[model samples]
Target: MDTAREFLENITAADQGDRVSRLRFAPHKPHAEPSFYEYSVLRGVRVESVRCGSTLYCSFTVPARLIDRNGKLSAGAIASLVDEIGAAAIHKCGKPMDVSVDMSIAYISDAKMNDELEITSRCLGQRGSYHSTGVLIRNRTTGEIVAQGRHSLFSLPATASKL
Candidate 1:
């Protein structure tokens, strides 16, 4: 918990120039914008932690609306959360880099609806044009691995216009 707090504080402090400031929670945060993953939810989403070089943390309180009849977070919603976290982490790596190429995600488990899910993102490595990272989404209460994925992103000097 201390680590999460520290991460949040660091990101907040470092966002003076509006670098990470734009990523903060907004009224539409949980609503899937036209660009990234969109999920229907009763609660909302917020960032838990983010660092300049290596770490990124985010969490979401999944509401009843997003769950399936089985009461678990839908796979699509989980994937969208992962994508948002991953993209944000990548954006913090340094300067904004365009999503020059294709990006993919692989899911591991189903998240329970109304569960508080915490996602941790790490920058694994970067070499030349290739950037590699991984995100692990887990149920904070159960410690169960809800989802995990690796993303291979191509960083370009050009930034893509937001949709």
Candidate 2:
């Protein structure tokens, strides 16, 4: 299946949910405001596919706009991409909206502009209202790991009662 398309569709579907759900998943969309980080920083990023059940595989080329002064991918951009991709993976695993409780990243190496990156995020598991996810960002051409991230999220309970 087209994992990237599914990922984007999941995100868009979440955005079309209830008001509170939209707030939790995409606060910017409800207000009709621009999300610079999502729109600009991650403009060309695409979800390539989903594999091994719930693992989301994505890719994007390093744009010059996201490069740091030292001519490498900025840490902030990397972190944002990890967070967003992690959320997408979590959404695919049944939870469409959640609030991140904890997040951490380990930078392995630097990537320069024009480098293509392959990112993968998988849902580790969920307990009670808490969920755990892991992500890896690698240099597509060199097969080098550029960063790893972990995300912890709390799934909001459904507010409406079942009829």
Candidate 3:
């Protein structure tokens, strides 16, 4: 595990142009520039992994701070999770693009505090102007389908240099 940690640290630290390109698909600084969902420590949410290709997949975990009065993860928090995942996917594109134009989330189950979650996204074919992707939120603890949704991201010409 220490080796893996060093490997990842090296991967992020190396100056290879292409390697930088790969990492550039993610936020400029993920831990430093978190999305809105990161505003409160209410829930523990972290970007677990990322994959970029025809589509993208990114995973986020909810800690437990932002649960509702009912003691479950808040819907707004979940929605933010989806947004962050989609935003991450866009960043992985390695080019500037418009933000999400359309999306629909369906809550399948509820998650409690301290329950780790994994969010998955897949490219679901695309139309001319819009690239579509499907997202899934699952509870790692119980393997419950917590939520599912589809998101449409609009791509535009890069406005500024990604570097």
Best by lDDT: 2
Per-residue lDDT of model 2, residues 49-143, tens digit only? 98875799989999987899999999999888878788778773443567788999999999999999999999999897788999999999999
Q: Which stretches of candidate 3 lie over 4 Å from their true place?
A: 1-60, 92-94, 158-163
TM-scores, all models, native as reference? 0.62, 0.74, 0.62
TM for candidate 3 is 0.62
Candidate 1 vs 2: which has more lDDT: 2
lDDT of each: 0.65, 0.81, 0.65
Give the per-residue lDDT of model 3 (tens digit) for 70-146: 98888887776776565555454445545688889999899887777777766676565567777788988788999
lDDT of 2: 0.81
The CA lDDT at 33 in model 2 is 50
Report how far off residue 42 is in candidate 3 (Å).
Answer: 11
What tens digits encode model 1's per-residue C-alpha lDDT throughout 1-163?
Answer: 3443354556645564575444444354322343222433213778777777868887778776567778888776666565556665667444544352444566666776567888898777888767777888888888888888776677663556587
